[model samples]
Target: AFFITYTYPRTAVSFSEAMDWTPGQLSGNFLLPSILEPGQTYNVRARLETLEDPTQETDTDWGVITIPEAPPEVPPAADIRNLDFGAAGGTYEIGER
Candidate 1:
């Protein structure tokens, strides 16, 4: 059997106090009173502290928390036509492309 563990940093320096995750089956998803500001970045970290037996304790893993970017100013439907199909189709042959 296994259990979920959720943890994060105690302080907020570059980011606001609010942060969250998306929909799925896992750990660390919570709603906040405020939304993240535009053009900002945040970093959060967590670890799993586990006990294999009554006498032994261990930290299984650690991970950085991700806060997804905000939606673009234009809606999907409105910007669908403006998409450049030529650039998206991988037709450009260059050093990087």
Candidate 2:
């Protein structure tokens, strides 16, 4: 028998389930959640155990890295050509002009 385990580094939640495998099945597939935290990595893998004894089990290496969320795009700042004293004039002083 085998199962899948998903670990969340930021949260205490753990999702696990038994795989639907046949007596001679060699391949399997799993679908994970679509949305994950940005700049974070989650752990996911499989585990196998003997039907006769559950204690005799092994864990496979983590084989997937969830796609990271892209950072927000920011526009470039505008350059200030000169200091302009608005209509409210109060003896404005320009420096290094």
Candidate 3:
């Protein structure tokens, strides 16, 4: 008899329901929710059951799922400060200094 099962890692609120599988082996890509924020974590779970006889069938296994944090955010160039000496110099006066 052959059986198939899937498992996911712990993650944040964002998670993927659609999964895929290969021949004999189990594998799939998860589409995470867009609402999920970057750098956040989540948990996931999955299970498999056999369809043999009621008395013979059993819950094969169970595991936890995890969703990785999103990529880092890049700041705009305009928001960055220009530290070049030639660009500008200190504006402090003798009294201010």
Candidate 4:
């Protein structure tokens, strides 16, 4: 006597708490590195752990995010020097030249 076997692939996720975040958008803020350096590539991915089967969890496609460099800090502007303005009706007109 002989026996036959059949196998099928899983098509759905089991009961578990998971998150589905929209691409190119931020749902909320999460803990980030204390200091994030600029001009660097970081690996980003979303995961969904299965309650029934830990090994059969789901993971989003891996993503590469490049950090941007911080803009240069500008110094405060200097104050205007002596601005001589004659009296209301004096010789030197305020709006002249």
Query: Which has the greatest TM-score?
Result: 4
Error of 2 at 18 (Å): 24
Q: What is the lDDT for 53 in model 2?
A: 59
Whole-model Cα lDDT per candidate?
0.43, 0.48, 0.45, 0.47
Instruction: Please list the residue runs of candidate 4 whose C-alpha ends up more than 4 Å from where it truly belongs after superposition.
Output: 1-28, 64-97
In candidate 3, where is summed lDDT lowest over 10 consecutive residues?
Answer: 10-19
Residue-by-residue lDDT tens digits, candidate 3, 1-97? 5533334452223213453332233445576554556655444455443334435433343243344456345565773366544545778556753
As for model 4, its CA RMSD to the true structure in angstroms is 19.4
Question: Could you give candidate 1's per-residue lDDT for residues 25-75 as a string of tens digits?
Answer: 343554432444578654444443333342443232224445565544544
Q: How far off is residue 29 in model 2, in Å?
A: 1.8
Model 1, residue 79: C-alpha shift (Å): 32
Error of 1 at 89 (Å): 70
> How many clashing residue pairs appear in each of the predictions shown?
0, 0, 16, 0
Query: Which 10 consecutive residues of model 2 have the lowest summed lDDT?
Result: 8-17
C-alpha lDDT of residue 56 in model 3: 47
Quality of model 3 by C-alpha lDDT: 0.45
Top model number, lDDT: 2
Candidate 4 lDDT over 1-97, as tens digits, reads: 5533322233343332545444443233344453444565455555445657768755556552333444344566866586666656558645957
Ranking by lDDT: 2, 4, 3, 1
